[model samples]
Target: MLPNIEIIVGTYEEFLLGYQLKQQSEEDGDQVVLKQTFADKSHAGSLKCVAVQGPWIASGGSDDRIFVYDMRTRKQSQILLSHSGTINSLVFSPDLTHLLSGSADGHMIATRVGSWKTEGDWQKAHAGAAVTHVSCHPSSKLALSLGGDQVLHTWNLVKGRVAYKTNLKSKSTLGSAPDCLCWSPDGEHFTLSGPLVVEIWEIKKAGVARREKTPAKPICVAWLNGRVCLAGLENGSIVWISLDAPEDEAAKNISAHEVRIKAMSYFDGTLVTASSAGELKIWSCDIEKQELEHLTSTNIGCRPTCMALLDLSSFKSECPQTSKVVAPKHTNQEKSNVVAAPKPRGVVTIEFEQDENPTIEDDDNSTTSDDTDSAKKSKTNHKKLKQDEESVGQSDDDDCEKSDDSIADFSDSESFGTDGFSNDSDSNQRPAQRKRRNPTPVGAKKAKPKQAKKE
Candidate 1:
């Protein structure tokens, strides 16, 4: 199922490309796509982010503009311009009716699909800082924005107001402002990462559900499942944490790249990660085992800034069928006789009639003499056990009562031990009495006695 996907990669060199992979044979691995689509200088910028849905792909970068392209036409259809600063992030709504963009100018604008008009007033999302990343909730009705001012803002698209805002600075230490944000598939929780900590939060709560210290600087983060999160570190490692475990325990770390990880995405059961060293790796995620199996790696010869997975199921309806490759025609073919199974006889019928009333039968009411005798013996044994337990309990209670009644008489009659002192009174005071007795110094003379004075 994953092999049918098409990958679109945006690069720091201002290049936007598409790739289609296929398996030529069972023994060999997948064949990488050599043909790619390139953009001209009219749409040039260091592509910072990209988003794909159905047959549409949107990219933004240093140009302060977004280029929306159609895969079926292989051309750019529209260019949106509303940002005063560089576009840092781009995301399409879950239903693909609106495109949301975050810019370094602290503004978030949503535009409709075909109209190319702004839907509502552009939000001044972060007052004094750039919006680093933004993600749409699964309902497509809310958007989450992470900003450099150390705040997370959740916007209500329908009402055109800020639904909730959370400050992500750590209370104990001050350097853990969030740099990236990812919403879970179920939309009940989200994750934030920066500096040394990764925190998971419930959508409705004001406090974090769990916070964990990472081994390296987490640059990007993604959710692998409901309970597990994958963090891409600056040192080319991916740390996997199980939120169900204690916060202080060690997380499983996998060495993924030789340099800082630039981007990562998980679709269906496959994971794709890229590094600054120009290496792209595909991994198969085992959800049940909580493990990653390395599938293949490709040297793209260029650093990738962002990546997106495109499902081409909708493209089949728009494109011509001849665009697909076909096997060569065989010249000399031999024909062979084939047999076909016979058809079944026409509509065999059966009939059934219902009875008004049915008689019931039960055999458990009768028992043999031996069974009755054994049952009686079992009842007697149970009764005996109950009596023995109750008698033992009553005897223990009586012994405790007797001890309580004799306490005063026992204390009045002073009893001495082998040391010739009452055990009850002296036992509590021996340690204090030992400290009061003075012992002379090892090498000092004894003190002289004092004489009485006359009036």
Candidate 2:
């Protein structure tokens, strides 16, 4: 595998840094190298969180907005603006079709990836409390979220509604809600940790399977190969919890860095970690033996808050970001709900094509010719339109494609299931939308209505 194929993107201070892990020669200590890609301010405020799936990357900060980017093109794709509070967490479903974002405003919303439209949202997902973390099941059907109210919420992705909620403040033994929540690689269990404790909970039963006291204050957690869970601690050490054998919990605790490890992610036996000291490290793990051999490390200039890995191996195709267009919705058959097993095919169907027929409406400064003259209605909407001449306000592809800003629109339907996870093509779902219309062919005058001549 190429060393730079998978890039590590981390949010440090107000900037976003990208790094690639290169394996060194065996003779030279066999260290892994942390090479920098870009280090620039990506948000107006300190970035709080980020989520990555396939070629799509999203980052949110105190700026109260989410910016989605296409890794293939390295360009900003869409700006999500539904939250009224600082964004806290973001998660893409295993299927890549759903994106769940939580904010300080106590709202967790599910959005369709390609359409970028709000699928189903819980207005008070956490009862007006900030959502701390969200983890979805491998099946992509169920999701669990931890809120500031010391409660946990379970959501049905297919139905876009709350499946159930557990109040931790009233029932758990932790004395307080856990700071971080994570699900295992398999769907059998999940873990909630805070300070000196880590508790594994069974998903099907919604009960604690076991609890282990950490030697150090646990900061974050990530699972590997569906059998082990690694918890990064405030003491700059790692405590490995064995899921395969409950009695072997905390069998290995090793010091990793000199500072608090804030974030970590695992992929195919490789691990990437970010620390409060603005440092990044790479390691190769032997899952059977529960070992992490350090390869290399590097320090940016500022402390990082969160991190995620973007696996490039999945996009080995000729056009990694083969763009797709969004046009007006048309008549088509509906599709079923989503399906998944926790791999990188999450974005296989996602497209990031630049709008070829952009209209004046998308521009912030463009004005309309509404009152100028009914005679000019047949002419172009505005001058210097960055639109395709061959297709004026029409989709080049037969698939329904709308403009970027027009991609997401709220439907007043009672059930969010059809809109949230349905496999139906978008064209079949937008029968009531009237925002866009096919413009008359150029040079064709508007024909007046017919009248009676025998009067």
- TM-score of candidate 2 versus the correct structure, residues matched by position: 0.66
Per-candidate TM vs. native? 0.66, 0.66
Candidate 2 lDDT, tens digit per residue, 1-455? 43345554556458777887766767746656667766656578888888888788888888888888777766777889988888889888888998899999988988889789997778788888898788888889999999888888888887888888888886555557677688787888888886688888886676987777887778888888565788899989888887667575445787898889999888876787878887778888888777898866788777888888887765543435557888865444422333436866332222223554323333333233333234254345553354565465454442244553444443434434553544455756644333443456799999899998996
Candidate 1 Cα errors over 4 Å, as ranges: 26-42, 170-177, 314-317, 321-455
Worst 10 residues of 2 by lDDT: 345-354
Q: CA lDDT of 73 in candidate 1?
A: 68
Q: Worst lDDT window (10 residues) for model 1? A: 430-439
Report lDDT (CA) for all predictions: 0.75, 0.75
Model 1, clash count?
A: 0
